[model samples]
Target: MFGLILDVTARIHYALRGLMPTNVLLDALHTRRGLKWGVPAMLLAVPYALAAVFCTSQVEAGGSGWFNLLALIFAWNALKFLVAGPLTLMRLLWVLGREANARRRAARALLGEGFGPELVEEPVLTSRRA
Candidate 1:
Protein backbone atom coordinates (compact mmCIF):
# COMPACT_ATOMS: atom_id res chain seq x y z
CA MET A 1 0.00 0.00 0.00
CA PHE A 2 2.71 2.40 1.02
CA GLY A 3 4.72 1.54 -2.05
CA LEU A 4 1.83 2.27 -4.38
CA ILE A 5 1.11 5.52 -2.64
CA LEU A 6 4.72 6.53 -2.78
CA ASP A 7 4.94 5.57 -6.40
CA VAL A 8 2.02 7.83 -7.27
CA THR A 9 3.51 10.70 -5.33
CA ALA A 10 6.84 10.13 -7.04
CA ARG A 11 5.18 10.15 -10.41
CA ILE A 12 3.23 13.34 -9.80
CA HIS A 13 6.09 15.23 -8.26
CA TYR A 14 8.64 14.11 -10.81
CA ALA A 15 6.31 14.88 -13.68
CA LEU A 16 5.02 18.32 -14.58
CA ARG A 17 3.58 19.73 -11.37
CA GLY A 18 2.41 22.94 -13.03
CA LEU A 19 0.82 24.51 -10.00
CA MET A 20 3.22 27.24 -8.81
CA PRO A 21 5.86 26.22 -6.25
CA THR A 22 4.69 22.64 -6.88
CA ASN A 23 5.01 21.77 -3.17
CA VAL A 24 1.60 23.36 -2.74
CA LEU A 25 0.16 20.41 -4.61
CA LEU A 26 1.18 18.17 -1.72
CA ASP A 27 -1.12 20.00 0.67
CA ALA A 28 -4.65 18.95 1.65
CA LEU A 29 -7.27 18.46 -1.08
CA HIS A 30 -10.17 20.15 0.67
CA THR A 31 -10.03 23.65 -0.67
CA ARG A 32 -12.56 25.90 1.04
CA ARG A 33 -14.40 26.62 -2.19
CA GLY A 34 -14.35 22.96 -3.24
CA LEU A 35 -16.10 21.95 -0.02
CA LYS A 36 -18.50 24.83 -0.32
CA TRP A 37 -19.59 23.73 -3.77
CA GLY A 38 -19.49 20.00 -3.04
CA VAL A 39 -21.66 19.92 0.09
CA PRO A 40 -24.62 21.83 -1.33
CA ALA A 41 -24.42 19.81 -4.54
CA MET A 42 -24.75 16.51 -2.65
CA LEU A 43 -27.40 17.88 -0.28
CA LEU A 44 -29.56 19.21 -3.09
CA ALA A 45 -29.40 15.93 -4.99
CA VAL A 46 -31.42 13.82 -2.50
CA PRO A 47 -34.57 15.89 -2.40
CA TYR A 48 -34.43 16.50 -6.11
CA ALA A 49 -34.40 12.74 -6.68
CA LEU A 50 -37.35 12.09 -4.35
CA ALA A 51 -39.28 14.99 -5.75
CA ALA A 52 -38.76 13.72 -9.27
CA VAL A 53 -40.06 10.25 -8.36
CA PHE A 54 -43.14 11.58 -6.56
CA CYS A 55 -44.07 14.05 -9.29
CA THR A 56 -44.04 11.50 -12.10
CA SER A 57 -47.11 9.62 -13.48
CA GLN A 58 -47.33 5.86 -13.99
CA VAL A 59 -46.70 3.81 -17.17
CA GLU A 60 -49.67 4.56 -19.50
CA ALA A 61 -49.86 8.35 -19.95
CA GLY A 62 -46.71 9.31 -18.07
CA GLY A 63 -46.66 13.05 -18.79
CA SER A 64 -47.02 13.95 -15.13
CA GLY A 65 -45.01 16.33 -12.95
CA TRP A 66 -43.26 13.30 -11.54
CA PHE A 67 -41.75 12.37 -14.85
CA ASN A 68 -40.56 15.90 -15.49
CA LEU A 69 -39.17 16.11 -11.99
CA LEU A 70 -37.35 12.83 -12.47
CA ALA A 71 -35.84 14.05 -15.69
CA LEU A 72 -34.83 17.34 -14.12
CA ILE A 73 -33.25 15.65 -11.12
CA PHE A 74 -31.42 13.18 -13.32
CA ALA A 75 -30.05 16.05 -15.34
CA TRP A 76 -29.11 17.92 -12.17
CA ASN A 77 -27.37 14.87 -10.73
CA ALA A 78 -25.46 14.35 -13.94
CA LEU A 79 -24.38 17.99 -13.94
CA LYS A 80 -23.46 17.78 -10.29
CA PHE A 81 -21.07 14.90 -10.87
CA LEU A 82 -19.73 16.56 -13.95
CA VAL A 83 -18.75 19.51 -11.79
CA ALA A 84 -19.06 18.87 -8.03
CA GLY A 85 -18.13 15.22 -7.57
CA PRO A 86 -14.51 15.45 -8.58
CA LEU A 87 -14.02 18.28 -6.11
CA THR A 88 -15.44 16.22 -3.26
CA LEU A 89 -13.43 13.18 -4.25
CA MET A 90 -10.35 15.31 -4.55
CA ARG A 91 -11.11 16.62 -1.08
CA LEU A 92 -11.39 13.05 0.11
CA LEU A 93 -8.04 12.24 -1.42
CA TRP A 94 -6.65 15.33 0.28
CA VAL A 95 -7.87 14.27 3.70
CA LEU A 96 -7.00 10.60 3.22
CA GLY A 97 -3.48 11.51 2.01
CA ARG A 98 -3.42 9.61 -1.29
CA GLU A 99 -5.84 7.85 -3.65
CA ALA A 100 -3.52 4.95 -4.30
CA ASN A 101 -3.66 4.06 -0.60
CA ALA A 102 -7.42 3.64 -0.75
CA ARG A 103 -7.24 1.54 -3.90
CA ARG A 104 -4.35 -0.54 -2.52
CA ARG A 105 -6.20 -1.29 0.71
CA ALA A 106 -9.35 -2.24 -1.15
CA ALA A 107 -7.37 -4.44 -3.51
CA ARG A 108 -5.65 -6.24 -0.61
CA ALA A 109 -8.94 -6.93 1.12
CA LEU A 110 -10.52 -8.22 -2.09
CA LEU A 111 -7.65 -10.59 -2.73
CA GLY A 112 -8.12 -12.24 0.70
CA GLU A 113 -5.78 -15.18 1.53
CA GLY A 114 -2.02 -14.62 1.87
CA PHE A 115 -0.72 -12.93 -1.21
CA GLY A 116 2.10 -10.53 -0.52
CA PRO A 117 2.41 -7.16 -2.24
CA GLU A 118 5.02 -6.62 -4.89
CA LEU A 119 6.77 -3.54 -6.23
CA VAL A 120 6.54 -2.80 -9.94
CA GLU A 121 8.71 0.09 -11.09
CA GLU A 122 8.37 2.02 -14.33
CA PRO A 123 11.29 3.49 -16.11
CA VAL A 124 11.51 7.26 -16.25
CA LEU A 125 12.09 8.85 -19.64
CA THR A 126 14.67 11.51 -20.36
CA SER A 127 14.76 13.87 -23.30
CA ARG A 128 18.07 15.06 -24.72
CA ARG A 129 17.05 18.54 -25.82
CA ALA A 130 20.62 19.72 -25.37
Candidate 2:
Protein backbone atom coordinates (compact mmCIF):
# COMPACT_ATOMS: atom_id res chain seq x y z
CA MET A 1 0.00 0.00 0.00
CA PHE A 2 2.77 2.38 0.93
CA GLY A 3 4.76 1.76 -2.25
CA LEU A 4 1.66 2.00 -4.34
CA ILE A 5 0.79 5.27 -2.67
CA LEU A 6 4.25 6.70 -3.23
CA ASP A 7 4.36 5.62 -6.88
CA VAL A 8 1.00 7.08 -7.66
CA THR A 9 1.91 10.22 -5.76
CA ALA A 10 5.10 10.82 -7.71
CA ARG A 11 3.42 10.21 -11.04
CA ILE A 12 0.38 12.42 -10.51
CA HIS A 13 2.35 15.12 -8.71
CA TYR A 14 4.64 15.69 -11.67
CA ALA A 15 1.81 15.32 -14.17
CA LEU A 16 -0.55 18.02 -12.90
CA ARG A 17 2.17 20.36 -11.70
CA GLY A 18 1.90 22.59 -14.74
CA LEU A 19 -1.88 22.67 -15.20
CA MET A 20 -2.54 25.89 -13.25
CA PRO A 21 -0.81 29.20 -12.63
CA THR A 22 1.67 28.95 -9.80
CA ASN A 23 1.23 32.47 -8.47
CA VAL A 24 -2.54 32.12 -8.37
CA LEU A 25 -2.42 28.86 -6.45
CA LEU A 26 0.11 30.39 -4.08
CA ASP A 27 -2.16 33.35 -3.47
CA ALA A 28 -5.15 31.10 -2.90
CA LEU A 29 -3.30 28.80 -0.51
CA HIS A 30 -1.42 31.74 1.10
CA THR A 31 1.85 29.85 1.33
CA ARG A 32 5.10 30.13 -0.54
CA ARG A 33 6.14 26.67 0.56
CA GLY A 34 2.98 24.51 0.22
CA LEU A 35 -0.75 24.44 1.17
CA LYS A 36 -3.21 23.60 -1.61
CA TRP A 37 -2.27 19.94 -1.32
CA GLY A 38 -3.92 19.68 2.09
CA VAL A 39 -7.68 19.63 1.69
CA PRO A 40 -7.74 18.47 -1.92
CA ALA A 41 -6.36 15.14 -0.80
CA MET A 42 -9.73 14.54 0.81
CA LEU A 43 -11.17 14.21 -2.68
CA LEU A 44 -9.25 10.99 -3.14
CA ALA A 45 -11.22 9.48 -0.29
CA VAL A 46 -14.31 9.27 -2.45
CA PRO A 47 -12.69 7.50 -5.40
CA TYR A 48 -10.73 5.23 -3.10
CA ALA A 49 -13.83 4.16 -1.21
CA LEU A 50 -15.52 3.59 -4.53
CA ALA A 51 -12.63 1.47 -5.74
CA ALA A 52 -12.85 -0.55 -2.56
CA VAL A 53 -16.43 -1.34 -3.38
CA PHE A 54 -15.37 -2.31 -6.90
CA CYS A 55 -12.73 -4.57 -5.46
CA THR A 56 -15.17 -6.29 -3.13
CA SER A 57 -17.64 -6.68 -5.93
CA GLN A 58 -14.97 -8.25 -8.09
CA VAL A 59 -14.28 -10.73 -5.31
CA GLU A 60 -17.95 -11.57 -5.00
CA ALA A 61 -18.06 -12.03 -8.74
CA GLY A 62 -15.22 -14.60 -8.55
CA GLY A 63 -12.55 -12.34 -10.00
CA SER A 64 -8.97 -13.13 -9.05
CA GLY A 65 -7.70 -11.80 -5.74
CA TRP A 66 -4.98 -10.03 -7.66
CA PHE A 67 -7.58 -8.08 -9.61
CA ASN A 68 -9.26 -7.04 -6.37
CA LEU A 69 -5.93 -5.96 -5.01
CA LEU A 70 -5.26 -3.98 -8.15
CA ALA A 71 -8.59 -2.25 -7.81
CA LEU A 72 -7.75 -1.37 -4.21
CA ILE A 73 -4.42 -0.04 -5.38
CA PHE A 74 -6.09 2.09 -8.03
CA ALA A 75 -8.51 3.37 -5.41
CA TRP A 76 -5.53 4.39 -3.32
CA ASN A 77 -4.17 6.13 -6.39
CA ALA A 78 -7.27 8.29 -6.27
CA LEU A 79 -6.51 9.03 -2.64
CA LYS A 80 -2.95 9.93 -3.51
CA PHE A 81 -4.25 12.47 -5.99
CA LEU A 82 -6.05 14.06 -3.07
CA VAL A 83 -2.85 14.05 -1.00
CA ALA A 84 0.13 14.82 -3.22
CA GLY A 85 -1.25 16.64 -6.25
CA PRO A 86 -2.18 19.97 -4.65
CA LEU A 87 0.85 19.98 -2.38
CA THR A 88 3.20 19.19 -5.22
CA LEU A 89 1.71 22.02 -7.27
CA MET A 90 2.02 24.44 -4.36
CA ARG A 91 5.58 23.40 -3.68
CA LEU A 92 6.37 23.81 -7.36
CA LEU A 93 5.03 27.35 -7.11
CA TRP A 94 7.20 28.07 -4.10
CA VAL A 95 10.16 26.86 -6.08
CA LEU A 96 9.12 29.12 -8.93
CA GLY A 97 8.57 32.00 -6.51
CA ARG A 98 12.07 31.52 -5.21
CA GLU A 99 13.54 31.73 -8.70
CA ALA A 100 11.42 34.75 -9.63
CA ASN A 101 12.46 36.61 -6.49
CA ALA A 102 16.07 35.83 -7.20
CA ARG A 103 15.86 37.22 -10.70
CA ARG A 104 13.99 40.35 -9.56
CA ARG A 105 16.55 40.95 -6.86
CA ALA A 106 19.35 40.55 -9.33
CA ALA A 107 17.68 42.98 -11.71
CA ARG A 108 17.10 45.53 -8.95
CA ALA A 109 20.69 45.20 -7.85
CA LEU A 110 21.85 45.93 -11.39
CA LEU A 111 19.41 48.83 -11.75
CA GLY A 112 20.86 50.25 -8.49
CA GLU A 113 17.97 51.50 -6.34
CA GLY A 114 14.97 53.82 -6.94
CA PHE A 115 13.34 51.45 -9.42
CA GLY A 116 9.89 52.59 -8.31
CA PRO A 117 6.80 50.40 -8.47
CA GLU A 118 6.37 46.90 -9.81
CA LEU A 119 7.70 46.91 -13.33
CA VAL A 120 5.53 45.86 -16.26
CA GLU A 121 2.49 44.31 -14.65
CA GLU A 122 0.16 42.31 -16.89
CA PRO A 123 -0.64 44.74 -19.67
CA VAL A 124 -4.31 45.44 -20.28
CA LEU A 125 -4.75 45.03 -24.00
CA THR A 126 -8.33 45.77 -24.93
CA SER A 127 -9.62 44.53 -28.29
CA ARG A 128 -13.21 44.27 -29.46
CA ARG A 129 -14.35 41.29 -31.51
CA ALA A 130 -14.54 41.94 -35.24
Candidate 3:
Protein backbone atom coordinates (compact mmCIF):
# COMPACT_ATOMS: atom_id res chain seq x y z
CA MET A 1 0.00 0.00 0.00
CA PHE A 2 2.83 2.41 0.85
CA GLY A 3 4.63 1.64 -2.39
CA LEU A 4 1.43 2.24 -4.36
CA ILE A 5 0.86 5.58 -2.63
CA LEU A 6 4.43 6.69 -3.32
CA ASP A 7 4.13 5.75 -6.97
CA VAL A 8 0.93 7.75 -7.33
CA THR A 9 2.51 10.75 -5.61
CA ALA A 10 5.53 10.66 -7.89
CA ARG A 11 3.33 10.47 -10.97
CA ILE A 12 1.27 13.43 -9.83
CA HIS A 13 4.40 15.41 -9.07
CA TYR A 14 5.78 14.90 -12.57
CA ALA A 15 2.39 15.70 -14.14
CA LEU A 16 2.23 19.00 -12.28
CA ARG A 17 5.84 19.77 -13.10
CA GLY A 18 5.11 19.41 -16.81
CA LEU A 19 2.18 21.82 -16.55
CA MET A 20 4.27 24.64 -15.01
CA PRO A 21 5.59 27.20 -17.54
CA THR A 22 8.55 28.19 -15.40
CA ASN A 23 9.89 24.65 -15.25
CA VAL A 24 11.49 24.97 -18.65
CA LEU A 25 13.13 28.27 -17.80
CA LEU A 26 14.34 26.94 -14.46
CA ASP A 27 15.81 23.87 -16.12
CA ALA A 28 17.68 25.94 -18.67
CA LEU A 29 19.04 28.25 -15.98
CA HIS A 30 20.61 25.30 -14.20
CA THR A 31 22.72 24.33 -17.20
CA ARG A 32 26.38 25.41 -17.73
CA ARG A 33 25.77 27.84 -20.61
CA GLY A 34 22.56 29.06 -18.99
CA LEU A 35 24.36 29.79 -15.71
CA LYS A 36 26.42 32.46 -17.46
CA TRP A 37 23.25 34.35 -18.40
CA GLY A 38 21.63 34.22 -14.96
CA VAL A 39 22.76 37.71 -13.95
CA PRO A 40 21.10 39.16 -17.05
CA ALA A 41 17.97 37.10 -16.49
CA MET A 42 17.49 38.83 -13.15
CA LEU A 43 16.21 41.78 -15.15
CA LEU A 44 13.09 39.72 -15.86
CA ALA A 45 12.07 40.14 -12.23
CA VAL A 46 11.52 43.85 -12.75
CA PRO A 47 8.55 43.33 -15.00
CA TYR A 48 7.02 40.83 -12.61
CA ALA A 49 7.49 43.23 -9.72
CA LEU A 50 5.86 46.02 -11.74
CA ALA A 51 2.92 43.81 -12.55
CA ALA A 52 2.53 42.91 -8.90
CA VAL A 53 2.49 46.57 -7.93
CA PHE A 54 -0.12 47.31 -10.56
CA CYS A 55 -2.31 44.46 -9.37
CA THR A 56 -1.93 45.57 -5.76
CA SER A 57 -3.01 49.09 -6.64
CA GLN A 58 -5.99 47.79 -8.55
CA VAL A 59 -7.07 45.70 -5.55
CA GLU A 60 -6.67 48.65 -3.15
CA ALA A 61 -8.77 50.80 -5.49
CA GLY A 62 -11.63 48.24 -5.10
CA GLY A 63 -11.23 46.96 -8.62
CA SER A 64 -11.75 43.35 -7.57
CA GLY A 65 -10.68 40.99 -4.81
CA TRP A 66 -9.38 38.60 -7.50
CA PHE A 67 -6.67 41.17 -8.23
CA ASN A 68 -5.12 40.24 -4.90
CA LEU A 69 -4.44 36.73 -6.16
CA LEU A 70 -2.82 38.10 -9.26
CA ALA A 71 -0.72 40.40 -7.11
CA LEU A 72 0.49 37.48 -5.00
CA ILE A 73 1.34 35.37 -8.03
CA PHE A 74 3.32 38.17 -9.61
CA ALA A 75 5.13 38.86 -6.36
CA TRP A 76 6.08 35.20 -6.00
CA ASN A 77 7.35 35.03 -9.55
CA ALA A 78 9.37 38.22 -9.04
CA LEU A 79 11.01 36.82 -5.93
CA LYS A 80 11.81 33.53 -7.67
CA PHE A 81 13.59 35.27 -10.53
CA LEU A 82 15.39 37.70 -8.23
CA VAL A 83 16.77 34.86 -6.11
CA ALA A 84 17.53 32.49 -9.02
CA GLY A 85 20.03 34.98 -10.46
CA PRO A 86 22.48 34.96 -7.55
CA LEU A 87 22.06 31.26 -6.90
CA THR A 88 22.92 30.43 -10.51
CA LEU A 89 25.94 32.72 -10.42
CA MET A 90 27.26 30.93 -7.35
CA ARG A 91 26.64 27.56 -9.00
CA LEU A 92 28.45 28.70 -12.15
CA LEU A 93 31.52 29.69 -10.15
CA TRP A 94 31.53 26.35 -8.33
CA VAL A 95 31.26 24.43 -11.63
CA LEU A 96 34.10 26.45 -13.17
CA GLY A 97 36.34 25.86 -10.17
CA ARG A 98 35.62 22.13 -10.28
CA GLU A 99 36.40 21.98 -14.01
CA ALA A 100 39.66 23.88 -13.50
CA ASN A 101 40.77 21.49 -10.78
CA ALA A 102 39.91 18.51 -12.95
CA ARG A 103 41.96 19.90 -15.85
CA ARG A 104 44.94 20.57 -13.56
CA ARG A 105 44.76 17.04 -12.24
CA ALA A 106 44.66 15.61 -15.78
CA ALA A 107 47.66 17.72 -16.82
CA ARG A 108 49.62 16.60 -13.77
CA ALA A 109 48.82 13.00 -14.57
CA LEU A 110 50.04 13.45 -18.17
CA LEU A 111 53.28 15.05 -16.92
CA GLY A 112 53.93 12.26 -14.42
CA GLU A 113 56.52 9.41 -14.73
CA GLY A 114 59.82 11.25 -15.35
CA PHE A 115 58.19 13.92 -17.52
CA GLY A 116 58.71 16.77 -15.04
CA PRO A 117 59.56 20.23 -16.43
CA GLU A 118 63.08 20.12 -14.86
CA LEU A 119 63.91 16.97 -16.87
CA VAL A 120 63.23 18.67 -20.24
CA GLU A 121 66.43 19.60 -22.17
CA GLU A 122 66.73 22.92 -24.04
CA PRO A 123 67.62 22.77 -27.73
CA VAL A 124 71.35 23.51 -28.41
CA LEU A 125 72.08 25.81 -31.37
CA THR A 126 75.28 25.47 -33.40
CA SER A 127 76.65 28.18 -35.75
CA ARG A 128 78.24 26.95 -39.02
CA ARG A 129 79.94 28.81 -41.91
CA ALA A 130 78.39 28.09 -45.28
**Highest TM-score among the candidates is held by which one?**
3
Q: Give the TM-score of each candidate.
A: 0.30, 0.42, 0.78
What is the overall TM-score of model 1 with all chains considered together? 0.30
Q: Please identify which of the two predictions, 1 or 2, would achieve the higher lDDT against the true structure.
A: 2
Roughly what TM-score does model 2 have, to 2 decimal places?
0.42
- Clash list (residue pairs), candidate 1: 55-65, 55-66, 56-66, 56-67
Clashes of 2: 2
Which 10-residue span in candidate 3 carries the lowest summed lDDT?
A: 119-128
Quote model 3's TM-score. Answer: 0.78
Q: After superposition, how far is residue 35 of candidate 2 from its true place, in Å?
A: 14
lDDT, candidate 1, at 40: 51
Off by over 4 Å in 1: 1-32, 36-40, 58-70, 73-75, 78-86, 91-130
Per-candidate local distance difference test: 0.52, 0.62, 0.82
lDDT per residue, candidate 2, 1-130, as tens digits?
Answer: 9999999999998777656444244345545444545465456567667878888888889988887776766676666555556666667677889988977776665445434345323222333353
Better of 1 and 2 by TM-score: 2
